[model samples]
Target chain A: MSGAFEIYRRWLRDRRRSTIVWSVSIAAVSVVTAAFFSSLGQSLGENAESGSTTSSMLGLSDGIDPQTPTGFLWAANYSNQLPWLMMALAIALGTAAIAGDEADGTLEYVLSKPVTRSAIAMARAAGMVTILFISAIVNLVAVAITAPLFDLYDSVTITGADGSTSTASGLTFGQLVVGGLAAFAVALGSGAIAYLLGAASGRKGWAMGGASGFAVAGYVLYTLSNVTGDLEFLTWISPWRWFIDDAMMVNGLTWDILWPFALTVVAVVAGWQLFLRRDLQN
Target chain B: MTVIEAQGLTKKWGDFAAVDDLDLAVGEGECYAFLGRNGAGKSTTARMFLDFLRPTSGSVKVLGGSGADPEVRSRIGYLPGDLNLPPTMTGIEAVHYFGSIGHEPDTAKVQALMDRLGLTADRPFHQLSTGSRRKVGLVLAFMNDPDLLILDEPTSGLDPVLQDTFRDMVIEHKQRGATVWLTSHVMSDVDRVADRVGLIDQGKLAQQLSMDELRTKSTGNITLTFPDAPDVSSFDGVEGVSNVQVADRQLSIHVDGPVTAVLARAAELGAVDIQTEKNDLEDIFLDTYSHEAGR
Candidate 1:
């Protein structure tokens, strides 16, 4: 194998146990989430079709119609939750890419190899992104499998209150796939940040601490930006804002989507440079 | 041609100078031993040679290139004093990984070294005992058969049998014209294998001596047991005798020169069970360091 692929393979082998745990957990969570949301969406659709009030069907008011499309119900109730879940998974898994090696005293051995320090950082970040992408695919599969079990099949169609029709036909799977890829890219950026911190500190605990602190700080900034008129610029700097704002799961992918990917590339390059220049004490 | 050269080599950590204004050169096919107490900067010097640590205000050239150049590194094999391998990797796997870095998958060299050192390939690094781990380090250091070999305490955990085997391996490498630089606390190892030895004390080169010269210059000890405690005072002013001790029936004298004078004195004392032993490297090493420290 070439150096890059060799590094990639080593990372995969190192994280094989974590990957198994994450895959199983994501699969379980996906199945439960998909089932719950599919059932809720089907119930709302039935109420809308029966000429009942949508509010009562959603348990928000009395007498709701049951003719609503299951796709509309699912989108209304679950679409926003995807970003939060994806962000949490990305931060947890991606942040460990560099930090874990430093903590375990393996960074020195890795650096002693012929591979450049920057390549070590980039290859590990890429591995984390790949793992996150695979997790997203597995989650999407679980959603697909469970959605049709609750009468939320491809044929269901419902009109929104705005008179816009939504259906499983309008759900572009390709767009969702691209959205997942975009989320993976954002994860790579987070991983790069963590890798740089790990390389600078030469301590796994410090790296993880810094990454966790950054993630929390990013979320707080995004939330504050949304709530306050001032400090609005925080949203642009927050990775979470970029992630949630750019998710186009059911909508078609856009060229504007390139912004997050570009940001990821920048973060990765910066991290690699920092890692290359730092002295690895271990 | 010199395979490694260091000029005015110095390394400092804040106020502490780990290596100070040191200069050394190793020619092709030469085996040089660095002798010193712990923390005497042997490892620091080696690290500087490998460019693992940048010198404060000096330079090191390896194989006719700057220490930091990959080309120089490609031609040298290094065993760090704190050589730690990844715990998760097997011996073979770890060797293979390092080989990959060197841009070749020479499993045969690794296997040959392991066989010579009796290192098992299936053993995980953490599972190996300390001696076995040291063997693994040795195998890694010599597996590449580079033009220059830099090792620190290379035989630390080796058993006597394996130590002999390793010595033979070093000799084989030397025969092929590979320069070997090693450090060890075992004076016998250095005395047996090193053509020349550099003694360092407190980060300073105290003395450099060839094996034959060191042996000839070192003090010898003579122990004599008498049937009755005869007057040992007569031997006190004898030539080449530095110190004399008289116990109830035994006399011990530290002598520097030909034992014939001390032997004649012993015969005059009507001494029985006379025994004479030359000062080995241990005595010379202790005296050398103590003297250097005092200076």
Candidate 2:
């Protein structure tokens, strides 16, 4: 096997237990939440009509009807909970990609071999992304399996902006794909930032703290912008804005999903360059 | 032929030089032991040989090529002083993992080493004893049968039997024309295996001498205890006696050559007891390093 793949495989094998735990935890939570939507059907519809705090917090803005299965699942689970968990997992993996091994003194020994430093960095980052993707896929599969058992596949009624009402079936499988894609993008972008920090500093604390701080700052900026007209421009830089503005699960695929992927690619390139120039910490 | 060469090698951290203008060479089939106190730049110099750290100044050549080249690295085996492996991997797994980086490992040889070193292959590295961990490191280093072996404190945590086994392995590798460069603060570990010794102090090469040369320069010592304080200055200005000290009824004499002159002088002084002590590598090592402060 090539050295890069060898290292990548080792990382995957080593992290197998942690990856299984994270994936199962997220998937189980999603399935349980979906199962609850059946019993909460009437109450959630009443809250959506009255515009309760819980409704707003779930991002049930205009055009989204919580009475429908798609809106209920997206609002109650995907919007806030799933993305946060994925972001946490991604960031943790990214921090461990380089800085964690460096701290533990494993990276130095690995680099002593005939393999190039870039190979090690890139392989480790790829391993982190693979786990993130697996977590998202696992959650997607669980929700899909449980959504129908809760009667979430039925037809739905919708009202247009012209005050006209219409009836339509639930969202298609394509919508589920776009929704999962959006979540994956958000998680990857944040993780890439952590990866960049780790590559630049070779310090796990710096990577973990810096990336988490950036994520929090972006969320706060996006939240405050929604409350005031003057701060609306700040939402442009927030990942939350891109994810929430288009309501990817309800709406079809949009250009906003591409933003995170672009940011991730850039982070990977910049991180590789930074890592190539610095000295390995002993 | 010289398998390893460094000229004007220097590594500095800010204003402090870890290694300063060092020059060294190890010929093929030669076991050159690098002797130094802690922080004397032994590891830093070794790091440069494997391109783990770039020199602030000067250059290093290994196996007649730049150490940074993968082709050059493929022919060298290195064991860092502080060995750390992935905590979850077993010894056998580590062997295969590191082997893939260089060449296909000879499993038979690996098993032989495991048996010889008394290492259990199934146990995870973190679960192994310190000696077992060192065994894993040794197996990994010698698995590829590289042309050059750069080991830093190769036998640090090993038991006496294992240390002797390690010395025998180095001797066998040397007979096959492999160049070995090892660093150690302990004299006994290297004194048996090394062909030449280089003493480093304060990141500088203080002395480099072959075993034969050192034997000639540092002769044995003889102490004569007389019945009384008879002619305390009897051995003073003796031709072969380089150092002498008189205390009570005992006279300690350090000789630079054959003990004939000192033995003759001791008989004339009516010595009641005579004890001869050979000059050991530890004494020479201490003399070179005691001047430097604790690093």
Using DockQ as the measure, the top candidate is 2
Please give, for residues A47-106, the per-residue lDDT of candidate 1 as tens digits: 545542333222222222233332342334323344445555565555556656655556
Cα RMSD to the true fold for all candidates: 5.8, 2.9
TM-score for each candidate, following the candidate numbering:
0.81, 0.92
Candidate that would win on lDDT: 2
- List model 2 lDDT by residue over A7-120, tens digit each: 999999999999999999988877887787656754666676674445545766677766577877778777777888889998999899998898888987887777878888
> What value does DockQ give for candidate 2?
0.63
Off by over 4 Å in 2: A41-57, A157-168, B225-229, B240-250, B256-260, B267-273, B293-295
For candidate 1 chain A, which ten residues in a row score worst on lDDT? A56-65
Segments in model 1 whose C-alpha atoms lie over 4 Å from true places:
A1-5, A40-103, A110-129, A136-147, A150-170, A228-230, A250-256, B103-109, B225-233, B236-239, B248-250, B257-273, B284-295
Considering the true interface contacts (CA pairs under 8 Å between chains A and B), give the fraction that model 2 also has.
0.57
Candidate 2, B87-198: lDDT as tens digits? 9999999989978876868889989888888888898988988888889888888888889998999998998899989998989899999999999866777888999999
